[model samples]
Target: MAVTFYYAPYSTAESTKAILAELEHGLPNPLATRIELSISAGDTRKPAYLSDVNPNGRVPAIVHDGVPIWESAAITMYLGETFGVRAGNDPHQSSLYPEPGPRRGEAMKWIVWTNTTLTVAGARLAAALPVGTPGAVEKGSQDEVSKDETARKNEEEIARGDLAKNLKVLDEALKERNYLLGDQYCLADTHVWTFVSWLSVMGVSTEEYLHLTEWLARVGARPALKDQ
Candidate 1:
């Protein structure tokens, strides 16, 4: 069966593309088609994509042989385990999913934390930043930091502070472990790195968090992640 990956560059969809790349790089994977959507052309918001692919009308969606899946975090876990089965490995023992054990539990923990807490805080910070302020990396996708179209006072200290709290938690969590789940690289690393790389856009410097900096280098060094 073929997988149809709907995407837009430099968006959250890159994380899902990274997973697909990793699976294919490691073995003869089931990853088949990659459909690049244009956020500028309103591709993601189109009627067909909204109805059949993602009801939420977002990129980074997957239609694995017609069954649709959305949400990058959910897609990460889905592909991690499902691709393992297609590769003749037990889903519970999947390399990306980390078998069923403590590592798996930790993976679940960090994934939920990144999606719910980290991303929420970051979005708030991005929303509060001034419309044309520079420093966000130009990773090919359109910048939404300026989407606060209505003129408003940008006293961004509060939003920045909230995100700082979350980042510090991540810093402390990674002070000792190599990855979110100890030393082994797994799905959590893949999912978390997706947004963590956008700290430049949030006006957050990584120099304060040494562990996070090193971890980014480590994860970003992976061969499969070069393009996506």
Candidate 2:
């Protein structure tokens, strides 16, 4: 059965695009047909999309073999385990997810953490930006920013400090490893890197963290992510 991926430009769906490309490069066959939706036009709010695709009405959902799956973590894990192989297969070896054991547990842990903890930290930084900054309006500022200028500035300071603390955690984890799971690149790397790159666009810098910087470079060099 074929898969249908629902995506929207300049959104979280890009991570799914990258992972699909990565998997198809080494899998036995093609993955799915991508259907791009326009969030600005309320495509996700359409009745058919809400009833048939994602009940949550979010982009990045996929319909595979007539059953729909939503959430980045679920989609990544399914693609990885279903078609993933280690290096040196006839087609090539694509690993969308980690193998069993300690690495698998760590990958699962970090996948959710990156989706929640790391991403929320990044969102706070974006939400706290002052008016007139590029991309701030698209990201949506805090409600407090509209009512209290002083509160918005306070929020920006707190967001900055919190993000630094979270980055330190990631930086320390990458100090002795290449990818999130030590050396083998998998879905977790792609998932986390998506948001990290997003944060950089909002003015968060990773240059000062030596380990984190090197890790980002290594992941950024992947062939699958190039086109996406």
User: Whose TM-score is greatest here?
Assistant: 2
lDDT tens readout by residue for model 2, 1-228 = 489999988777877887788778745667889899987577887899999999887879999889999998788777776766465554445556766777778878887887778877766666667655743534331122453778778877888888888888999999888988876888888877887877787788999999999988888888877656
Taking all chains together, each candidate's TM-score versus the true structure is: 0.83, 0.87
| Worst 10 contiguous positions by lDDT, candidate 2 | 135-144
Candidate 1 lDDT over 1-228, as tens digits, reads 578999987667877877777777755545658899887678887899999999887888988878999998888888877763334545543476666677667887888888899887666665555544553323233445443434423436666677788878888888888888787788788888877886665568777888988888889888878666
Model number with the top lDDT = 2
What is the overall TM-score of model 1 with all chains considered together? 0.83
- The collision pairs in model 2 are none
